[model samples]
Target: MTTFVSIGSLTGSIHPSLSGVLTKRKTVLNCPIHGDYEAEGIYLGSILKTQTKCPQCEEDQREAREAVEAVMRQEAIKKEVEERVAKSRVPLEYRTKSFDSFRVLNAEQGKALELSKRFVRGWEKAKAGGYGLLFLGSCGTGKTHLACSIVAALIANHQFLFPKYYRTSEIFSAVRKSYVPGSQTSEDEVLNYFSGIELLVIDEVGVQKGSDAERRILFSILDTRMTSNKPTILLSNLSAEGLCSLLGDRLYDRVRSKCVPALFVGQSMRKPATPDLFD
Candidate 1:
């Protein structure tokens, strides 16, 4: 014979120890479907155990889960709406111009823009999936404008999407100012915001000299996004060689792995246009 012990009893008359002994010897433990009903004396060691829902408990759990899911869905929708609004607010002139419109720009720049469009469109096809593109080129070559246009198209399609634009110098300075040895909450918040955005556009990369600590923050953000397969767009005057010079071999390698590197070649489009606008 084997000795067994019970834990507690539902009815006042039955001893908990006896209940445990019966449950241990006859009923199954940790059985979500049958354990509760079996303990109530509804099924006394029957070959086929019957399952009865605890109406109050079941309803409560169901309602709680529904409440959480409802809130999450609402938050997602709200975020999407906000992104659309922000993108819409960008000037029409900036958003309308695309790779095709810039006649002065070279074929490589046009190809780069097409690649970027494909990357963004691919993300829309898989909304839940995170992916990103990086545009590495000198200033005045329409990197920012193209990024904004892509965001505009996504918003126009009424997709749940958003683009977050940041200057590398701004990020570097903010991360540096927030550092106080152990306090990284501000830095974490920045990283969290960056990670959640559907697209991240970083302009003027290598514009600022980064300390070791600053580089660490940048690495953390990039690593987390890369691991999550989120899309990132980098706009810089630096070439691939220049990036290697600035960010070092290790970090440059990480960036190269995710990005389809493209060179933007042209006279500075930001310069005052000639009388004909194309000369």
Candidate 2:
């Protein structure tokens, strides 16, 4: 026969054989471990349901919720950053952009992006390793558009750690100005910014003249990134030969080693890039 008893340690069903003795001993059968005593009590779930909650399960749920919240927060931040990047890009007004209205149109621009993606993807394969690409062609060949599109994609699709876009002269000048006498900024800060980025797109390369001093600073930035294995995107109007003439051997060879040059050959895409021209 089963008997129920309320005693010191027993709060639920108690076997008749042990009930009287356990009651006299101030111990109960089927008693759930209370809050503090939960760890010490040996009770089944059926009895413990009336006692204290399972702390282990409670802790697990809390952790799981926190993890889910963390993931959601990260995804939100990533989306925000991508939107900002897309907005900050140069408007299609100044140029005919193949990446804007049509990224996969006739699959031509898509093919270009795909070729570029192969290099960028390599960096991801190596835990963010690999170098950059130098897109050299005449103006209106969609070099800048492709370069900016890459920055957009890396920020949008790839979730690259931190991507930055700039004209070659802008960053080169910034680094140089920082080293001038009484300047508030330092060279280290410039290098730190360039070095830390996961991907850097430098457009209009060879468009500006660099003093020997500026050349040295430019080399410093490129060499540092190369050694650290950060990828860079170079868009320039200069031919491979012309680039070698302008940047000199050191920078040339370094860029040459890291990048696969894609020569854009076609009539100027800018002459008539609008739908109106087709009419």
Candidate 3:
């Protein structure tokens, strides 16, 4: 036979199968915030102990813990992106540039901004097709600003992407230095480094003297990138006709085949909006 006894808010049971072992009780426990709830209490001899918790409060606490963990994960990702951007070799002046920071003064600038964003959004497809961008216009037209913005966006979105930024003059300078006697680096080493980058941005494209040797060096680097199905961004102040003349037909055609031109037009951003006091 089984026996039951009521004590305070607890109802306890003693079963014949466990006569001298222990007893079980159903007890009502009060929660300050959630009011009273029923819980199971265990008895060893005369001592009764209950494991009590408010189900709703436990659920809320669990959700809060998950929310905190989620925020920490996001912060970690942001920090990683900042570290990678710092190491990406983007110039100090342009490292902080982003699509949101780009100022669109006119419709053309607005179109340019949108195009840059679309390129980032479709980067996987662009990378697969070896497609890139050509930022053209006169100086101070935000060409480099938009280019760096693209690089920054890519770095943030793609964990493993390798991006490099260099001026047209720097490329020639590096290769020229490699030709010096007793130089540790070779010409092929310099060329191969530029060629192997996952994404390459060459700024000031038409700044170099249009010599046959310069053209050859540029051709070798661009041709290798094309063959590897890698993309290259070209930033130049030269008009389309002038750029075509500088690059000559062969290299110009190679660039046109894979690049979507975003022509930025307007006065120089470096120019002040208001008239100078002396003017």
- The TM-scores, one per candidate, come to 0.58, 0.59, 0.82
lDDT of each: 0.64, 0.65, 0.85
Model 1 lDDT per residue over 1-279, tens place:
322344333466766543322233333334454344222323323212344445556777899999999999989976765556565444445655554565446887778778767865676543444445567676677777777766665664555555666777777766655576776567677767766666677777777675676677677777777667776777788877887876678767777777667778776787675799666
RMSD of 3: 6.1
| Most TM-score-accurate candidate | 3
lDDT of 2 at 98: 32
lDDT of 3 by residue, 1-279 (tens): 223344433224756443443556666777899888776666655666555477778988999999999999999998988778778778888887888888898888899899899999999998999899988998898999999989989998899997989998999999999989999999999999999888999999989998998999998998888878898899999998998998778878888999899888988888566757569
Q: Model 1, which residues run further than 4 Å from truth?
A: 1-101, 125-130, 176-185, 273-279
Residue-pair clashes per candidate: 4, 1, 0
What is the clash count of model 3? Answer: 0
Instruction: Provide C-alpha RMSD values for all models, in order.
Output: 15.5, 10.2, 6.1
Better of 1 and 2 by TM-score: 2
Clashing pairs in 2: 10-28
How many times do residue backbones clash in model 1? Answer: 4
Global Cα lDDT for candidate 1 = 0.64
Pairs clashing within candidate 3: none
